[model samples]
Target: MGNQVNLEEEAVGRRGREVQRDGEKRGLEGPKVLREECPSSRDLLNSLRQVEKMLAVHEASYQQGLRSLRKKISALHNSTMAIFRIGKNASCPKPEPPGHGRRLGRVFGIGHEVHFLCKPTYELIGPRTRVCLESLKWSGQQPMCRRVNGTSNSLASFSPAAPSSSSSSTSSFPVSAALSASSSTPASSSASSPFTLSSSSPTSSSPSSSVRPSHCTHFLGSTRCTCDVGFTISGRDNNICTDIDECLLFPLGQPGRLCVHQCVNTPGSFHCFCPAGYDLARDGRSCTDIDECENRMHNCTVDQVCVNTYGSFQCVTVECPQMKNATYIKTSSMRCERNPCMLGDKACTQAPNSISFHFLSVVSNMSAPRVLFRVSAARVLGDTLRFGLAGGRGRGHFSVQRSGRQTGTLLLVTPIKGPATLEAEVEMSELERNALLGRYLTKVTLFVSLHEF
Candidate 1:
């Protein structure tokens, strides 16, 4: 019975071994026949699986290295194509000289210690003299050598690089195609065609007609164009621009329609232009002068009249613009009236029953064609009606005195500066009288009529 029992135990052991083998093969069974099998067998099987995963990880890393190498090769190939491949009809090219073959007396010029080996200047043993490129020593592969026909300063030719492929001649882009890009532009163009680069200057054979002015000189601050403002180039050539004057060539500043108007054109600068019938004032602007004689300058010609008009000198037998209350004063005094008080708005102060005046302290504007001054309370002191307002308290009186010259007629009332009666008096020189008298007066007219005078 014991033998029978031993046989049964042996049969069970063999069956367990077979089940474990089949499990391992199916990847489901292993040293453990089932999930509930011995734990030791499960642990051993897991350890073996870990070893397989580590091996796979190492192999995948190696494959990645191969992919990187492939990328590097691709980059190098593209670089080689860019640098070495020449396109047909290349725009600009570097010159390349032909190569000469190795001579019988050549040298292996490569490697470092050449001079120590070969003498500085060694001639070969041949009948035609030649310098040994080989250093003094008997070592090294190739040595530089040359025939004795040339002098020492003659350039030594180095090994030439490989020859590049040549291109055919008929590869130029069409000229019409080059010109098509900027048809609207009337200016010279260099856009379409391949323009040659010269270290010095452009060659004569090139189309200079299509080039811009090489150098432009400035006068004052403006550039001088060959053509004037209204004209343009008349021919295909660059230097053919023309000038045109629509106005008759009237001398500038003279009475005219166009040529040489009131403005002066220097080499570069230009003056403001004024039209005829308008007098050009000092600021070169148009202003009207009243015809005081017509309305009257003095308001009376034979008596005391002179008139002013815009740009023109005219005689008006009519009423004056300021006649109603125009206080007669010396024509020379007009400038003083512009800045009536040297102190401007601060010239006076207001008081309840009356107005007070501030002495201008140190006054200015005294140097004028006609100096005008008003004594604050001169007339208030009952000085001979020297100044009288519409409502006469005789509070003020103004003085118009000559400090400089006046070109035309002048009439003014004497100021109370002295005991001179402050009465309206006509002051005229012999020449002034004749000029004022229309019968003997010459009508001097304005050159430019930007202003009426």
Candidate 2:
């Protein structure tokens, strides 16, 4: 009976190993979705559990097997990452416990910060640290992250790698020390294989694996967020910048996949970054316009157009012609001739100095409510004018007669006028014109005129 039990346990271990190997092959197939959880991931997690159980049950032959299996599990774990932003961060989630696999820092930036291991489980997407700067308020829209000032590479919290107070400091490296610690046991020798700590400088490695550089922060790409060449955020915008996905809004494929470059957005500006394209100037704040034309990196065809915006450049097949007719949203209009004594030279201008708004009085349909105009102008409170008229029925819109003056009377002197005369150029909308017929002419003219008085 003991032998049979051993055999059954051994069989399960062998099967688990096979399933895990299959998982290794499948996991590396492609890029996983950003900030999401999938069933396959859960399945992989379950396999790790089974492997852990198998090692525990079939204690003898599986001891050595467990070591090898653990290595593979770690490798698989480090290949991906999961990004789950907190709408309102509740309790920080524990990374898949122990054998669950390596995931990156779930809570990034500052604000109710809880320390969880940041492991590079998958490719980093969006910003690495959603840092809320202490210099900013929560309701703030543009949050800031510290970008590396230069090319310094140091582990963020390693005991030996304390940060320097100098303006230039090494940034956070995108490696998983804590995640590495998960698979490596307290007694295991292979622990250090996954994590390399240099005795001289316990900080992180170079260019790629670095932390938030001192005095600079703006990350939209991954856990290993390196800011664009220029632009640092100490507490500038308070780290409330919303992600402006360039791919979603603009066509970025031109000029050798321009969108492939970094698309970091600043408070009032943004830039497209390339790995080795150009470096920012010493100013460290503004993106010194890269003259792509001079860089020999431009992918423009022989006859194409190249237009330079603030930070980046674009080559276009069809250039936009200058605006021929731009529509300005209308805010105010005025009636110029209220009194018959007003127009020196009556003109049809957009904003006439002397003007008035007309109010609707009699309508063709009693069922349809009359439309009234709410007037607002600096001249609305001035002396009112009166103009009396003889003609009672024109059965059409009447024109307001303006008498000659050096300037026009701009006040609404209402006592004048009956069946008001109006200039006939303005027409109502199609719906309104149709509704105006057979209606009693409410004969009132809204006018704004400029008089010396």
Candidate 3:
């Protein structure tokens, strides 16, 4: 019976295991089935519509928040820049402690003014007050304190006696400190001192109180100071300051003047300039064309011509004849032969017996008769040929000269009558071995006509 119970228990356990296996399989298949069963298109569309409505409801608020955030960031950035004076350090000048003078407001800040005062018996020179300019500089130099009598030097002797009510009232704490500092320096009285002023006062000192030359009328204790950047100290002691000309000191490609052409130095400033053929551009540093031809500044005459070049113009004289119907042919270095005949007509002809030539008529209003024609020939027969004027009866009306064995010139004088024709004849005797072999004759005809001139 026990065996039977044990077998029954084993059977029951096996059946429970099979049931558990089936449940595990169903659990794994559940997710796969759900994944395969996609939602309907209509349901997806409905969900998307709801999302759109929600996004539309929040879009305006989100954009408004973004704009507000940007505004806040920009304001913060600007405030931070103002506080730090970013990008302004090099452009702004630092404050300089005045000697024997009183300064008000922030000296280092732009648009701030500084006023000055002198001791009772001293007078002030230069502007009484100066203001800081946008260029980061004081408007004027520091004023000097001179004695009332105008005979006291810049470093006048002062007694260490108790100050008078008037002297104490006029001097401020800063001014007094500056004056004291300026007076204590040994350089103030030296000849090398730039602030050394002439003194006409007689040498006189009281025995009860010791007196020393003082550059300051009030007490301000400080040592020598240097000038700001772009400035140099002048005068003997290097107390007088002046602006340095960067254009003159440094050339292009250096750390100074940026001018491309010429550089001009002005008071406390400098500028660029261009050459004669160029003009100053709107930028004031660059140069452009002056356009001499376009501006009618060229010296070309009517017969001459003008051509534009880079930044300048060129004057060119008409080298060849510019007549409408004539074609120019170069005949010599100094003259050009012009042909005015039609395409088929012969302008010049040469032959063994007769040579004929044609030239365009020239009309002039001048009184003097000009040379109408010129001809020259080279001898091929050595001394066997003789050339002379022949067919014209008015030979005396023209001047003739034999330049060489085969060369001659003909000049036409003032004509007494109308048109005339002239002819030249050449007679040649052929020779061989210095003996005559044959004779030949050549003739050339020239026609000359004069107008009313």
Candidate 4:
């Protein structure tokens, strides 16, 4: 009975062991079964890795293709640039030279050069030479020929033809004798030269005898020639004589000018003229200012006063304002005095104590904000004083500003057209602690002339 019981226990232990083994096998198989139901993790990971590798390859290929395209574009740009360069190197358009000028060098290509020249009387204004560049353009600006500003000093010298025996005495005529006659002659007369042969000479009988004359001296089969006082020989041809333009040669502001204001050039001489409001003095080159006011040359009316200025004259007038209960007295030519006001007369008391007239000449359209006139009190005993523009036709163009304790300035605030009159009433008020003392009115008349100087 004991042996049987021990065998039974061993059997029971073996059965329990077998049951535990079966449970462990089921646990392992459970995961395998679930993995089959879904997708395998290892297969999924391998597929994702392959797809990533394919995408990397595609990206690399795309980048390589983009690089290839960029290279082709660069090559095309280079080819186009080369073609443009070739076209530009072929030729350049011909340039036109200025009037009275000529250009040298016929070829117009890259790195080529050209030169310009002007006539004898003209002057070259711009670059003398220019070069064609690779960019198909000239290197410098096109040259121009401009007429010279002053007269030329070049002389024309020629040998006089052999004089006949009858006229040999007059061949060496003295220039001094002709100078006196030329001075007395008018400038508008034709040019007369002492070197010219008279019609009575034997050589004058020929129809082709040259009438042009020059100062000449025969010495040992060689002749020396010269030009007269007011003439010079041409640079190109020594046989030709040209008049000297004294006006252009000696312009204003330079020494040796013919006139103080204006110089008019003629065939062989020049004339001096003075500007308006001036008289030509005894000395032909100088000028004297004309007193239009004294001479009564102005067109001023009886009410206007004639004022003289440099190179011009002006007419200006100022009248006292008409007001009720006020009486004005003419103190002087340019001043007026008011009678003392009555104690009960408010209108007379409020009016200006004195009114004065002033005339001034100004250039047309002068710079604005310029101080035109100044008003000042010789003595200041008031507590306060003020200055202002009262009323006039020119009030809009003017302003009054205080310059000092007892001085005020009338300033031109705006520019105005001239050949017209500008009238302004400037009033000065004296106050003792804000109480009105007296007001003086000044009637300023400005004569704006059309001339600048």
Q: Estimate the TM-score of every prediction.
A: 0.17, 0.15, 0.26, 0.45
C-alpha lDDT of candidate 1 relative to the true structure: 0.29
If ranked by lDDT, best first, what sequence of candidates would result? 4, 3, 2, 1
What is the number of backbone collisions in each predicted candidate, taken in the order shown?
A: 45, 65, 15, 2
Top candidate by lDDT: 4
Q: What is the lDDT of residue 423 in candidate 3?
A: 48
* Candidate 1, 1-453: lDDT as tens digits: 999999999999999999998777888545346666656767989999999999999999989999999999999999777644533222221112112211221232222111211111232211211222223223423333333222332222111122112221111111111111100111121222222110111222332222211111122232222321222333332233222222223344566323223434321112345554333445433333433335433434553224343333433232212222222222231111111322333322110111221111111112223332322221122212122221211113322333333322222222222211121221212223223110011111111223222
Model 1 lDDT-worst window of ten: 176-185
Ranking by TM-score: 4, 3, 1, 2
TM-score-superior candidate, 1 or 4: 4
Candidate whose TM-score is highest: 4
RMSD list, candidates in order: 27.7, 33.4, 24.2, 22.5
Judging by lDDT, tell me the better candidate of 2 and 3.
3
Expressed as tens digits, the lDDT of each residue in 1-453 for candidate 4 is 999999999999999999999999999999999988898789899999999999999999999999999999999999888867687456678988778877655688887766665664454556656788766789888877665433322111222245323212122222111111111100111122223211111212221122223333344444344433344544232333345567787798776656778887654446788867778888666777677888888899988878886567777665565778998877776877789888889888888889888777776678898998999987776899899999888788999999999999999999877777888989999998888888998888887865443
lDDT by residue for model 3 (96-179), tens: 444554443343566555555544445456655567776667798867755555333344333222321222111112221121
Q: Candidate 4, TM-score vs. the true structure?
A: 0.45
Off by over 4 Å in 1: 1-231, 244-277, 281-307, 311-453
